[model samples]
Target: MAELQDELTATAEMGELAELSSPTEEPPAPPAPPAGDALTRARALLTTHPVADGYCGLPATLRTLPWYDLELGDSSVDTDIPRLRDGGVSALLWTLRLLPGTAHAENPVTAVLEQLDLAKHVVAEYPEGLRLARSASEACDARAYGRIAVLMGPAPAAAIGDSLATLRALHTLGLRVLTLSGASWATEAGLTRFGEEVVREMNRLGVLADLTGASARTARRVLAVTKAPVILTHSGAHALNSHPDNVPDDLLVDLAAAGGVCLVPCSAERTGSALGDVADHLDHVRRVAGPESVGLCGAYDTGAVHPDGLADVSRYPYLIAELVERGWPESDLAQLTWGNVQRVLRETEFAARAAALRRPPSTARIERLDT
Candidate 1:
């Protein structure tokens, strides 16, 4: 008891002596950099890497006259394209402007053609800053030339209908990617005979298939049939939050095994309106299916609320920097940024050529589910 009391008294006396001498101590270390600033060096590293946005939405007025004429510095515009380039984004999958529904259009094929025309018009208008990339190598060329490579695509396989000829035509029209389900739809065990044929054609035509808004079952079936690596361009880990939009861990594992990448969606509705939530989704996918299996798809200009720290495309540097601060090595960050998806894109091109030579157009008829 005496020893304990003496020890306490000695600690108290020492504390008091230290406090008295504290005036001579150096000023407390300057406050640490703001969260974003801490990642400054990491952001700089992005310049040397080819950063790609797996999915990016566009305004409803995409086809309106002179929409592409908006100046780069125009903050009034929903997406600051110049800002995206400054942040080191070299390639992006820009969605095609389609009519309301697949079946409601007067001439669906013409609608598709019009969307392609808009894409070409933008590239022509901004020749120095943008170009349409039809292959992975073209994207790399755009990066070397300091231009943003725009890869035009559409959502939902339904838009192409059951026409293999349309799939081939779209590929020739500069359509390089197709989001599996354009919007929310019913879930099924797997692809219908018609859907399976669609995958076969996509694999043959060199169009990258994205299961962004697809149901879990449909994703599995597509994964099973797609000969090339697939992508879930903008999805979250369901195990973390169980949001309908989030992909479950089992599917993630399957996706990785099938050589596909799951690009973490930056939607506030799924990851919350905080940068930390975005990091959480990234970390969870990394933990569940390795960092190589994960990538990013910032759905900018989609009208979805964004995290304060990531309000626009210019803020990508902060996100990359945050991951670095959390001890993510540069190599892993490369895969998350562009390496993995680049490889997938390149391989899809090769697979397409092979399929065109040896694989015949699927003779399978459309198998109706509603029937």
Candidate 2:
């Protein structure tokens, strides 16, 4: 019995020595909590690469409520200073007029000028929140200053009334985008002779031709004639929605080849009322037109209902988070949100400079050219 007890004591001592010789190990790290969720990653990504929204109809809405204080946030509107900041939107191209064919103003030019004035006044009133950006560099500068860059225009081309000089005047008044609209320009036969001249002058002036509601023929003609990249500021993939305003795949390919961007809108009429529906359109655009050719626009304050997850400006990160969940790389998302639009604006400026050196301002009149 004593021998057995001695043996047991020896065994206990051996076990103690083995325990002392063994290295202690930490418990598994609980999987590190995934580093962050998709939404967190999306917000972080947007900090470096903020969204350059292609369209916002705040100006048009402001025209009606001239006294509306944007600083105090408006529940009636989808856009406001607080919401814009929350959205991580660094830049916006504010439409200065109603959609084409909808404005029944006796003088469309005068109406557009009124909207432009209102937009400038609003920007000036909220200097801390907004900065008027005339170029891509200016927009980036605004972002650096922690301000939202507001770019105005693409008022109906008809607003200029077939006068290239009027177009120049509008540019002088801060018109960076000129909508190619009206019955004569966007028909099946394509741009009239005057329309081509207007596009040429726009190229020389550094104005982007906005093909928001243009027909395929007009889009093709502009692609063929303009030396600068164009933008479909608020559109979707027709293949997905079949809306007349949605761009078809063939045009998207042509637009991509021309170094243009198709800014996908969150309009439920075109993309449905679901967040996945908007993402689907975005994916379709990216697939058909390539990554560099896709962009985002909330189309807020435009009298159109937005998708479920993207009902207002503040929901942009949610869309980005959805894309992140779909395995989109950071680089591609960067281009989609910011880089592509900035590149388009930069290229448009470059094309204008080159065009200016080659030709004088066009004096071509609609009466003389079209008739």
Candidate 3:
């Protein structure tokens, strides 16, 4: 910890503090939406499939948009989904819109529900997103948001001004989990004593607490207070990936011990799409928390698309191949792919209710998919 602090302090004091994007430093404009053969090639690779008859339809919260961000060129998204899918991922734990902040989120849930035909994931929500969820089915029919899971995060209990009202709104909108904060910062809900009271309230209302993107201090404090299993949605075990965004392996195990599930998000923030990086987090979690505790909270940006390294979701399968080569057990693979996340979601009241709801295309839940 001291080492990291020193590194940061030295960097800051050296007058190397970060600068806002000057006109030139700005994200290079997206190359003309990948036209002609390039567009065709990209589409061919990222093709999505609809659910087959008898196959359970994706939960409303798990859909992703048709556009993949990596194609646009982003640095933070990971290549794990393509790689992990190679052998077979158990289930998709989508925390779409990513979680840099309310402002930094990308790929809205509605986008996924309407497009992104390949796979599905759960979503994290922002204030605007919450409002959108209220009528995603209707909006999409008009060719708007695709809509998916609300990786619903509660401002740390410390943060929520009107807990009862906020949760009531979330429940009305069908939000399942609330992570409490975005990455790195602490919220009021994550505050010391008062936070616990909020957790109690969330638990009563059936909201799971998400601990990912939480300050390390917040992690230490929040876990001590909450009663329900917390989720570190879309995160990596730090021991291996070693990024600030990742939870340390020891901490991940502690989260599991506290009965929380740690979601290994497949983004560049941690392993940068190295098959080894993906495997390392999964392995660490499995070794410590056992199978029941870990799952993927994928935050891939097939839209903005990273550089050559972790790039597109087309590369998702590569991770699976690496796991297989290492002789990973098939059962374990199942857990990572879908089993773990499924268990987590299903156990939640929201999933159970959603499962009972109509999935038939003509059924009410299926509004005309937004264009």
Number of the top-ranking candidate, with lDDT as the measure: 2
RMSD of 1: 9.7
Of the two candidates 1 and 3, the one with more favorable lDDT, higher being better, is 1
lDDT of 1 by residue, 245-347 (tens): 7889898889889888888867898777788889899999988888778988787766678877888777788888888888888889999898988888888
Residue-level lDDT of model 3, residues 211-270, one tens digit each, is 766776777777776544577666677777677667776786687777667766556556
The TM-scores of all predictions, comma-separated, are 0.83, 0.91, 0.53
Locate the minimum summed-lDDT window of 10 residues in model 3.
49-58
Q: Which residue pairs of candidate 1 clash? A: 156-182
Compose the digit string of candidate 2's lDDT tens values, residues 1-371.
Answer: 99999999999999998877777944456755464498898899999999999989888777666467678898878899898888889999998765446554657888888888888888999999999999999999999999999998668776787688989999999999988976465566789888888889999999999998887788889999999999999889999898988999999999999999999999999888899999999999999999999999989999988888888999999999999999999999999999999999999999999999999999888789877
lDDT, ranked from best to worst:
2, 1, 3
Runs off by more than 4 Å, candidate 2 = 1-36, 99-104
Task: TM-score for candidate 1, please give it.
Answer: 0.83
Which residue pairs show collisions in model 2?
154-177
Runs with alpha carbons beyond 4 Å of true place in candidate 1: 1-37, 59-61, 64-71, 97-110, 182-187, 363-371
- lDDT score at residue 102, model 2, on the 0-100 scale: 58
